[model samples]
Target: MDASFDALLDEAAGAPVDGWDFSWLDGRATEQRPSWGYQRLLGERLSAATAALDLQTGGGEVLAGAGPKNFPPTLAATEGWPPNAARATRLLHPLGAALVTHQQGTQLPFCDGAFDLVTSRHPIAVQWPEIARVLTPGGSYFAQHVGGRSNVELTAYFLGPFEVGDSREPEVESAQARAAGLEIVQCRNERLRLEFFDVGAVVWFLRKVVWAVPDFTVERYRERLRELHDHIAREGAFVSTTSRTLIEARKPAP
Candidate 1:
């Protein structure tokens, strides 16, 4: 209803949605970080491994940020989107990390036992059998995944009530990994706090993370967005919960 809210909506709507960077929302939104420090742990594992693969490496930002010393002798990253793949190549090539583009939710483009350390951050979908097939014996798969019902509050706000069930739950994933012949090493999950200070941040988030509200569009949710804007104007910020899961699994030695 206010000029500020309308301006934010227009600005965020026109903002580039390329790459995995969320720095644009820096001062406008906040999320509590997982205590395990995923990048730090991933760096440690990569430094100790001979070869490594990073799955769903959006723009290779996280992988590249892990530092040169943290990288293994052979490092490869896979991205599904074209824009992200190009960006990833630009960022990762200088670091000697090869970038491979493949369709998401499909089989990875790598040989069996191709990597000893496989990592991913917020992978859209985990093909357990394919992951196990590509990992070397005794190799490990480590990742921080979006846990069950992540950002559901935000989705419910726009799309109304929806069933999430146990999808992406750590326990269920651990069981599936074991079924795929990977031994679970560690499993941890937590619910983090999230806050959005403006409607622009919400628009940008929904646009980038399409899965949050599958068919989210400004035209479709304009009324809801306006209501949320009014609520945030009165409440200072819109708060929500985000769930995260960290899992480590190892393949059995031959």
Candidate 2:
């Protein structure tokens, strides 16, 4: 409603949200990193892998962060969004990695037992059977999944109270992996702190991470955004929790 709110909303709305890079939120927001250091661990795995695949590789940023030197001889990634797919192609091709534009929840285009290592960071959906089908015998799937109810406080603020389902729970996913004939090697879940310093950060976040408020829009949630802006002005920052799960599963050797 106010000039500040309008300016913030316009800035966030107009800013580029094409890639997975969140550098735009540098000072506006902060999120605690997972203790396990997923990138470091992924680098270790990539260094040892003969063939590897990264699913839902948004912008291929994380995979690229693993360092080109650590990349396996055969490295490939899949992304569904065309903008992100193009971004990934530019970032990965020079690193000797192939990028494929593949739809989420659909069967992966790779052949059976094609890769020795599979990885993803915050994949929208995990196709367990497809993951198993693509992994070689004794190969592993290591990923950091978005846990159930992640950032519920932020979502609830905009959408009001809602059912917190078991969609991305580690236990539920592990069971699915087992049913898919993959042995759960390790699973860990952690809740991390997230802080939005201003309303613009919230706007940008909701715009980028569309799942947070499924139907979020500046016009649609203008009143709610104004209220949140006022609250942040008074409180200095709005805090929430982010849930993450690190899972490692392996196919049977036989």
Candidate 3:
């Protein structure tokens, strides 16, 4: 309603939401980190592997941060989103990792037993069979997944109460991986704290993470936004929980 709010909204809406980067929301929002330390674990795994594939590597940010020294001699990454694919190329090419753009949920373009390690962080959707197919016997798949009903409070605010379904449930994912012949070695789930200080941060987050509230538009949800804005203004921040799952599966060795 005020100039500050309007300016913040316009800035968030117009800002580039490319890649998986969230630098813009550094001071406007915050999220508690998972205790398992995914990036640290990934770096350790990458250090030991001879060949590896990173699925849905958003801008190769995590991989690049892990440093080239940790990477295997043969490294490849795939991104489904175009903007991320290009950004990944720019960040990973010099690090000797080839970036490939492929449609999510489709067959992966790699030979059977092509990689010794496969990793992904918050992939849009996991193709269990493909992961098993590309991994050699005894190879491992490590990932941190966005679990079911993550940040549902935020969704409930905009849209009325609705079921999120079991699509991203850990049990469902574990069963699928097992059916694909991958042995579930480790599975951990956690719900972390999330805080949004203003309506602009919420707008930017919804736009960037499109799956959060599909078809979200400020114009369509102006009234709800105003209400949430007022609530945050009065309460200081809007708090919610975000669910995440850490899974490590390995192909059985014959």
Candidate 4:
């Protein structure tokens, strides 16, 4: 871990992510199919047309899922977390995806019009214009990001005094993309529901699934989890909701 990231991590430590994180989803963020979801957005057509550059590539799950052989041999991923970079590389090495590189999301080190496609999955540090600047004029951009106004009920329950959700509206992000000179192709805001066996289970899932949380105390979370379990067991199930957005945009065709 970079010592610089220590302050960032500290600032976010145990803090509930207004955005998205693995801690909240419990290893199930990508496990479920959207019957009508963005898998279609990341379709063979997009892959075929794109020499993709994945930004903020996490554990390399997105990289592998996108089919390394189908995309450009030079298809690359950017990651700043050394641990995440190492883990992603090791995880995708078998797929011939050693193409991953270490970099930050805010600053892409590529030239103007360097790629045909760029993808990000709910980046904690969103720098869309920087991402737009490196893409080919006719290229496209795709992302599956956490929607603003998500997880209100659960967040309110768990962190009573705190504002639990970040207001990243799809319209706002899409508008920003447009302002950056990227044309909006398609945008979808979908609601996802998660059920916790109990409150502790929910906290554990949130910590792992929604890695965006910066302020968390195991004991505090556990106590709330216990209360939640009792309440849910007596009721039926605890329902937590999240709104996710899938965005597709394009640079003007050259």
What's each prediction's TM-score? 0.98, 0.99, 0.98, 0.78
RMSD of each candidate relative to the true structure: 0.9, 0.7, 0.8, 7.7
Regions of candidate 4 where Cα sits further than 4 Å from its true position = 1-35, 43-46, 98-105, 161-167, 209-213
lDDT of 4: 0.66
Superposing every Cα of model 2 onto the true structure, what RMSD results? 0.7
For residues 1-254, could you state the per-residue lDDT of candidate 1 as single tens digits? 47898899999999998888999999999999999999899889999999999999998888988867788889999998999999999999999999998897778889999999899999999989999999999999999999998998998998889988796998899999999999999999999999999999999999999999989999899989999998899999999999899999999998
| Candidate 3 lDDT, 86-173, residue by residue in tens | 9999999999999988899889999999999999999989999999999999999999999988989998888889987998889999
Cα deviation of 124, candidate 4, in Å: 2.0
lDDT of 2 by residue, 162-221 (tens): 999897998999999999999999999999999999899999999999999999999999
Choose the strongest candidate by TM-score.
Answer: 2
The most accurate candidate by lDDT is: 2
How much RMSD separates candidate 4 from the native structure? 7.7
lDDT of the structure predicted as candidate 3 = 0.93
- What TM-score number comes out for model 2? 0.99
Whichever of 2 and 3 has more lDDT, that candidate is 2
Off by over 4 Å in 3: none
